[model samples]
Target: MTRVLNFLRRPFVLDLRALALLRIATAAVVLTDLAIRSTDLEAHYANMGILPLHVLYERNWNAYQVSLHNISGLWQIQALLFLVAAGFATMLLLGYKTRLATVVSWLLLVSLQNRNPIIGQGGDDLLRMLLFWGIFLPWGRMYSTDAGRTEPKPAAYSYFSAATVAYVVQLALVYWCTALLKNAPEWTTEGTAIYYALSLDQVLMPGGRILYQFPEVMRFLTFATYYTELLLPFVLFIPVGVPFWRMLFVVVMYGFHLGISLTLFVGLFFLINMASVLGLLPTPVMDWIDRQVRTRTQRLQPHLTRLSNWRSPVRVNVESSLNLPPKTIQILHGLRNAVVTLLLAYVCWWNLDSIANPSLTMSEPLRWFGYLFRTDQHWGMFAPAVFKDDGWYILDATTPKGRHIDLNRKGRPLTLAKPASVVSLFKNDRWRKYSENYLFVSNAYLRPYYCNYLLRVWNEDSDNAPVRRLDVIYMKEVSLPNYKVATPSREVLCSCETAPPAK
Candidate 1:
């Protein structure tokens, strides 16, 4: 038992620099995500948006699932929530009130994600989990405004703790679960997963188009992706040569995500995954980075000194002046540890249960806990099989003047050439996610909502005003070897007419 405890505690001895980097990266990702969502606030968040409050509640209502977003149907309210989320993210970035900032950011992220579950992806899940774990970590031990001012500086590394164990295990489970679920022949025998993924016009980027020309390269990448995911996670457990393996894993995985980012526009998925890998960066790497930064700072010392002299000297201390009694501090620490341990244990159970039975249903208590904390996780990402069908959406509309036009093509006729990047049709990731969901015919509930939303958008626009009717059309392409093309099929999903104002 003692040996087991020690083994589990090993990860807690983390390099503080790595945690600091994680704080910065996570904050940056949060801010970027907020900025992207802000571009189409009404469409993604407001009641008049594609996923109105009524539809969202109807689809996802549960006794335990909660969100501040449900409190208001107004765009202004959602905008306030967005601003509040941004404030928390900014606090996290600056490492001001680091733990409080992490908690607030995580809560806001959960609320926003629950607000429109349809638009969420694996990246959002990973981001939420990271923030959850960040709450228990002393991430502000170094390079943070929350760091001690009176006491001596903290050590470069943190002591081993259960939180660190949870962090490492959670990351490993992501890869392990994803690898186990990918039982498709393409991932094993055919090595065609990458080919099909790149062929998908919806997610494909410019680099993917170029890479599609090389079948052998795609096949190689498919095998590499699967094997790396399947095998690399085991390295985290090896006792000897851990640093070497961990560093190698970080580098390879970071590069893999970079390649994915270039080939596929998966929103913040690549960025969040890359940031998670930063935790595995060995102490030597973190030390080397610090050395490089110090060297650069020394080189620019004169300029920095001049700039510093120009600004008024300000000393802002974060430590509390009223020190609590020893007993009170001990009690608080004990309570915190207990809470963290329980949360980590519950999360572990959920992960193991998911792996044991992908379709397993949680008990009411577990489900409630997951919903309340927004810690629910699903790791099936392109598992079982890669999507064989890929398509683009076209909103066909008829103006009052009797002109038929594709709303996505700036009121041009449907026969006009498709855009080079179909993704450009979406204002943000939320719209892209909704578009992907609408591709499935069985998602009947989304059809009317989306069609009506599109009609409203077109009619509201001065350029395409006085619209008569609108039809949601999907143009689909199936993958073929040697990049062969088949006749595209145009299918109408749903139609809506502009409702005249009440007299």
Candidate 2:
């Protein structure tokens, strides 16, 4: 017990400057995101803020009425909570009262994220989780409000080891899982899946229709894509030949993401994936970048110096020329004022976001990055309508020949929805087994590329066809999972439209 107590209280040396900088940069980016999103507040409110935090709250409270926009809590009460959250976040950024502020900030952020339930569960959210884990590390030693602690550097090093590993491991897991999920039959079956996907107007690329003319290339790409996703996990881990393979993977991934951004219109997902490249980059890269900035600054310094000298005689030395406070007195006074201002500002910001809405803030980037936190991705097969049984809903996909071929309801087809009618489908036992897994789910999902390109589908209901709208749902991401993987937890909600009456 004494040993445990001592361990918890041990003094550690940490590079507070680096940690503080990371915190500040992350906060600034988040603040920018918040400002950009502020205008969409009404849209979010209409959908209950679309943040996952809100969903968690609604579930916990069993009260759907206490949502954003309609915010029913007393003004004073909400303000207090918001203040505490924001104040704690500021303290964390300034490296003051770190232990307490860290915990308080994490709780408040999580609370806020929960309030929205839909908006806060993305790559940024993952980073925030990682930041929380980093709080226990000795990151407050150098650039913090408590900068002058007399702790040994090695003491802080131990804390960093685990925290760093946790962040890296979690990030790797996300990629691995994503890759594994892309190996669906529709994605690998070659010319068939891409055919149907390109036909969908929303997902059309620049020359997608023209590219469809070459069926062979589509088939080749389908096979290449599956192997690429399947091999990436091993390439990332192995020691000798891994680096070369990983480089190839990077090229392919960047091309794929770029293509999606240009052609598919769903660029946000790709943008987030590309930003994740930062995880693989070491701090030395940032250091190198900083050095280059300094070099550039030095090159320009002489010119700036001459300009300053030229203006010196004419410019007023304001404070000194105006005969203001003496140097020593001013220095002391400035420091004192800074501390007071920081405290007050922290309080004000915390209350505005944390308490008032309890749906605005989230954990810092580092902590959330420690885990691959994502919502359910279980888009079932897309067709015109939906059909549901006890736990399963068999879906249909069409072929180019225009025949009604069903995998679950009728029989497996070789391709997805290309023909006006579903026919000539392909289904192996493995594919059939995996489709069964989606039986109980109710949200976005992905299946493997059996023939080529990721063939995505969703199973949902719509108000357009009240009675007959039980059809299969389909959409495509450029990739699919074709590797061994741990199946994800099933808790998805369907937003897919099922089969409906013919117009």
RMSD of each: 3.9, 16.8
Off by over 4 Å in 1: 1-12, 148-150, 295-335, 356-361, 416-419, 500-503
The best candidate by lDDT is: 1
Tens digits of per-residue lDDT, candidate 1, 117-137, equal 888899898999999999887
Model 1: how far residue 17 lies from native, Å: 1.6
Question: Candidate 2 — which residues are off by over 4 angstroms?
Answer: 1-29, 46-109, 118-125, 136-160, 188-200, 203-228, 235-259, 266-268, 283-287, 297-503
The backbone clash count of each candidate, in order, is 3, 121
Q: Tell me how far the alpha carbon of residue 42 in candidate 1 is from the true structure, in angstroms, after superposition.
A: 0.3
Residue-level lDDT tens digits of model 2 in 179-204: 44444555544324544544444344
Q: Looking at model 1, which ten-residue stretch has the lowest summed lDDT? A: 306-315
Alpha-carbon local distance difference test for all models: 0.79, 0.40
